[model samples]
Target: MEAERLRVRKDNSLLRKREPIPFTRESNYSTPVRPPDNDELPGEKKGLPWPVLLFLVTLVVPWILPIGPLRLSAYRIVLVVMVLPCLFMWLTGKVGRIRLTDIVVLSFCVWVFLSLIMVNGLSSSIEPSGIMFIETFGSYLLARCYIRGPDDFYNTVRALFLTNLFLFPFSLIEFVLGYNILHDMFSAILPTFNYPPMAARLGLSRVQSVFDHPILFGIFTGSTLALVHLVLGHGDNIARRFTRTAIVGTLAMMSLSGGPIQALAAQVFIIAWDSALKFLKSRWQIFLSLLALATIATEILAKRSLLEIMIATFTFDPLSYWFRRLIWSYGWASVLNHPFFGVGLERWERPDWMPPSIDNIWLYYAVHHGLPAAGLLLLAVAFAIWAACSAKALDSRLCAYRMGFIATLMAFFLTGWTVHYWGAAHCLFLFLMGSGAWMLERKANTGIELKTDTIKRIPSSHQRPSPHRNAFTRRILSETKLQISRKELPVLNPKGKVADLLP
Candidate 1:
């Protein structure tokens, strides 16, 4: 009886062990495992493609030389290099599918070409139109194709941070000495415009760094600050994050542009909000409430005109308000007259006292490209916002980064209302859009791959069993039945009597 009880216990243990095998095997094959933290998943190779590397080099070139030979900008030279290789790659069918955002950008470029031709005539508009198309649409396409995933995105952030760091000493020298060494060096080699001496504001000389104007330098620093913050927020090393943040902040202050100050303030607010309310159930509700409060404040200040109030509050110059007001008045009139395709790239008719260049980006676009092109630009921005909001990646840190990026975009748009960003400055906006589009595309591809894997794993109803498996199962059942019958049959013991061994 004792031996029999031990045998029964052994059998029960064996059965329990056997039962877990199938469950474990099923789970191993059926359920996907989450990747270990900080480790990239298999098959995702790191490193930027050559085109992306070229783009990064392009961004850095203007800072190094500011201008190239024959009065061409550094960006123009890089664009030529990028376009040729991209065209060859596309012709060879090596490029990915053309996204909707790409199409929209191309369409806007086409409209610009047609409008220029209509206004300036084909012969006169050819060079300007071609340059516009290449600079805007071509750059966007190159960015869209080059940035493939989060790795690329992070690499870009790192590159920008390094670029800012590299330019910091130059900026400091300019600030202290009231001279730009880079400008002087580049001017010697290339024919360049003679800019006025650095003007003192708030008891310090405004530093233009390597950029053409103080405002542009400030804008670049401000934009880089946002990206650095995003990377710092997601980074693991505390010392490195703080160091980068300090460098970016110092550069921003050196630029002495109100835009960077305002942008940095927005970034600080975002970081505070993230820290305080990130875990809250209705964090977005809190954000909306804050926005409502701001709107109410704006309404209360409307009696004095919000523009005047903003100028008084954020800017050092009081005359800026009257200046912008004049631009707006004339720009609106021009838009009203040529509301459709614009006045065909013609200059706005304003009094000689008024500035020729419109400071507002939206007004500039409307005056140059017409309301339709402006509308398309807004639509593209809207799409990018949607894509950023919708992107979901395997790395959990991506959500916070995306939100930070969106906040930066909002800040840029608001600050851009006071300044017209052209040339390379415009590329920053395009790069942001391309990054968001890449995230959305990656999310979509991941979903499709998951679905494909699932379809491949599931057995089809029409699939027949393999002959070997069928034969093996039948043989096992027959052997089990034979053993049971043998156990149930009567057996003769030493007493020569029929004895049943079943018990």
Candidate 2:
């Protein structure tokens, strides 16, 4: 017995630590055989695409670079430089099937040229119209071409968070010091326009960071709050998600701009509504019904327009609300006079002392470009949101992405009513709309079928029992890089077979 015990210890090695040899597939098929990670999947073989990274970096960088008489903005330069390649990709159907957004956006660009030509003759028109096209179509093209899938979409959300994370400290410093160090530093180095100290709002200096204006900075950073909080951190740790979101929200707040704060409020309201009544299946319909009732109640009780109340109540101050009311009243008049093709960049006649800057984006486009341009732009934004919502998600992560995408776009949509986006902000908005349109294209893809042996051969330890509706099936679909739907997964995993195959 002693001899046998010694032999067992020596040979079988009960006391010895054994290293686990991971399972490997015998088949030569290139399919990855691993369970899905909670956040990122196992099958992403490539790095984040370059076009996305380039544009995003360009976006946050300081805007103007003075060379001779012309002021060349970095975002526009990047957009213009990439136009040809993106256009070629579009022509080749590399950006997926062209949809209504694409058609309307392109048409809007054409109308801008027509309006400019009609007003400012073709010679002067070329420069302005061409720049507008580069800003609009170029940015859209890049997103359409490169941001093709859920992974790409999430990467974008992650990038936005990181970029803003980098900006967080600078924004705080700007607010506390009552000076924009980066803006001043960049001006010294580049011989750009030296902006005077902006007036304090809410007893703190408005933080512009590297953006052209504080409002722009706020809106741009606010754009990422919903996306980073909900989408990128969907399957991540709860504490970490809130921390990240708080950082982003604080960064946005440095600007003290009501437009972006309103945008953030809109997202929070939507998120709160969604969370509070998540148990109910038709929560959205109920919310809409409630909103309609509230609107009707306000209209009857307040003896004022809902629009007026919303604008006045949501602003940082009453004066801002009043100014915006004046803007709308006159901007609408300008639109009415030149309905089809509005005055092309010509100053719309207002009171002599009123500010020349148009604060509203929809009104800006309608007043300068035309109502058709504004209508098309509005249509494009609506379609982008709807397509993302309507397209099915492959898994929880993707569902979170759809949620974030909608929220971010909604923020932009709401923000546009009070603030005009130019330079980087404008491009980012168009790029986002273009990026989410791929979800519509995704719906057209047919699901791939996996042979039953693929699952059967996977060892029981590696396979988790997922029942009829399986997260594992979604994982498998992702692992194989296929677009297989949840409905068809039950065919392979029968009620009895799943347990029988386990051992």
Candidate 3:
């Protein structure tokens, strides 16, 4: 009777112990199932996401299509294709959390919509306003959804880099031949739109390449230089990185646009600052103090606004300075007069002698959309910069890239004071903003998840013991006392007899 009772107890304990072993194994295995790092996940196909691929198509299509009479550019066509996908993503919850940056962007769009209606009236403005909203805010949301992680961001950069590489030869030809073959070919097929006279500087023709103007080409190439650097910075292979860097740098110089050169300089400066600040104990405080001092010194020394100084420094044209001064003076007056809702999109009533073009982008927005709209736009940019700088949880290299993006943006904004960017270049601004916001949100969420996991891993004193604790303890003690491996232990069968687990 005693032997039977002992056998029954042993069988019960073994069965209980077996159950907990599987559970412990499962927990141990699953504990390592972490969120993906900056690598392609298993079974994930390595390719650009659909929306990103579509965005790249948009960038290339503009160069291929003839400048049509109806303003049906390639950008419009691709944006139309993007609409359904973006809407579906939003409805299906594929689009991630709505963030503050998103809210600001949307608000800016709404303000632009209202400005158009107020200035142009509801009936006349609906179509153009819709197009603008779709082109700007819609594009931004698409980027935000598609560029969810580092892989997507790098893919986008690669796409841009490839596009630039393809165009580099054409750009060089245009400069050397002092003529644009692509534009000429397209113009033959479609009604030739009026373009500015090709300007010459330093014995070279200012080449527009595949773009509408030299300034646009310069800005595009310059901004891309920063992105190329970002990609090359993270590369493990030194030879590959050096080769790519050389190619991109050579292409950037070939464009010979002051705007891009300024942008490239700005990126280099920001990168150096980032590197230097890392060594400082109070980096943020020191950086801010330096920034303030620099701003004050610039104001005192220049005696003109920093915008004017930047414009003067980048341009060799004697008339460029006077022209920008006149535009700013007239543009500011118009903005103040129509401070709430801008004067209708109609040409500002100025003395016939005054220049029509408001070269400054901020002034352009203010003059057309009112101060409120411009303010929201600036605020959105501010939010993007803040997000980039504050993203502490991102990979260090990615954080550096984000800072480089911010620098690129700042350079563009500064350049906008001298040159007007429309079409694809303007879209690039929204892309950067959306990308920055997405990265910031992703890093923050990952950090939060890690913290939650850490907290969950900590044992609580109030936790109850498992129901099978005594059985588990007995089984473990028996195995230890017997000095046997788990394979040597007896397994319980339906008939309550010891069975060999191993063959």
Candidate 4:
């Protein structure tokens, strides 16, 4: 028994006090180190500086650039080239993973395709452009997938607000300077007039800002301005808040596309929307400011003989009051004539006979796609809204985007009564709303909220063993390398240490 115990002690000593192996250049093949924290590395964070910058820049180009035959509209062109290619890449898995929102949007687009195919069979002019609308929406849905988290979302919202901020200065300048700037700016490219009478006559010509037309400008800016106020609220600083309030309010007002009465009323509605959305303390402040704006607008309109101004400004025909009603009647008649698979997208407009009289968007849908198409479209819209409202309430950044998107839609809904600008921006906003919905659904599925920063813990593979950093691991790897160089591992001495083995 004593001999066996001595033998065991000797074996334990051999194991505990193994001699160190001599170092070589090859000894550098060491164990890999891992970071202690599970947080995602900075390199992994998504950076979209260029795309976001270009996107924001595109939104305001309409106001700053000269409009003519040759000057390319950046806003329209980006949608075709940048948006389409990116979308295709996403669908094919060449780009990042497409989110659930993208799938939903694509499904809806497929529905549009099937419907449009039927439209084309029925009416030849209902060409592929109608289908392309769904395609555009799909692109936006995919574009948003690149947005990784809350910071990305906040960046987008900031870009949106800053882009829209240009409206304040542009409209204000137009309102104060009247026709002088407009005539001078357009004179080089546009047909020069002797006196530029149209400019002076129109009194700021309802300056469309960056948008293509006055009415579109009014609606777009009005909606966004209202949305900003709604999200930001009237905070502590009275001066800054009121200044923004005045600028946006004035822009909406000076946009005389609504003439005097409608302009005043739209501003009131904008204020009311903002007031309704504000916190209790700020709510009263907004309400009082809104009342002041109303009083001022009313006084101005009364003095200017607003009703006469409106009559004169809007008088596009001999029996002006009846003309819109007459056109709408014709529009309804057209819808009745082609109820199912209505007039094709290209077929609906005839600039020669009359300047595309189907101004009402709801009616326009009915006229273009029939009751089934219109009904399906409305149902999709209703679902999107319900989804947005029912989903988790967004943070301030997301709130701005959501409110901006919805407000823009509402503006379109109202503007459809008079004009049609729902081609690109309309689809963009829809896709964004859908994407937002998808984000919420994803959050729910993960059983996590946006604010959480927990990193996903991927299990290490069998081939990649658990990171044990014992001397054997380093010794084995180094000896393996040296053996590859010298053609075999060095023989070990009876002491079981490579160092003890000499040549």
Query: What lDDT does the true structure give each of the candidates?
Result: 0.64, 0.75, 0.67, 0.48
Write down the TM-score of every candidate. Answer: 0.75, 0.82, 0.77, 0.55
Q: In angstroms, what RMSD does candidate 2 have relative to the true structure? A: 7.2
Residue-wise C-alpha lDDT for candidate 2, range 93-162, written one tens digit per residue: 8777777778888888999899898877898888788878998988888898888777777778788888
Clashing pairs in 3: none
Candidate 1 wrongly placed segments (more than 4 Å): 1-28, 31-45, 60-71, 84-97, 189-193, 304-308, 443-503
* Candidate 3's TM-score: 0.77
**What is the lDDT, from 0 to 100, of the residue 96 in candidate 2?**
72
lDDT per residue (tens digit) for residues 276-313 in model 4: 77666465467568777776786687664333344445
lDDT of 4 at 33: 26
lDDT of 1: 0.64
Best model per lDDT: 2
TM-score between model 4 and native = 0.55
| Candidate number of the best TM-score | 2
Kindly list the per-residue Cα lDDT of model 3 for residues 55-91, writing each as its tens digit.
Answer: 7656644443444433656666777777677767755
Which stretches of model 3 miss by more than 4 angstroms?
Answer: 1-30, 40-45, 63-70, 185-195, 237-239, 249-255, 443-503
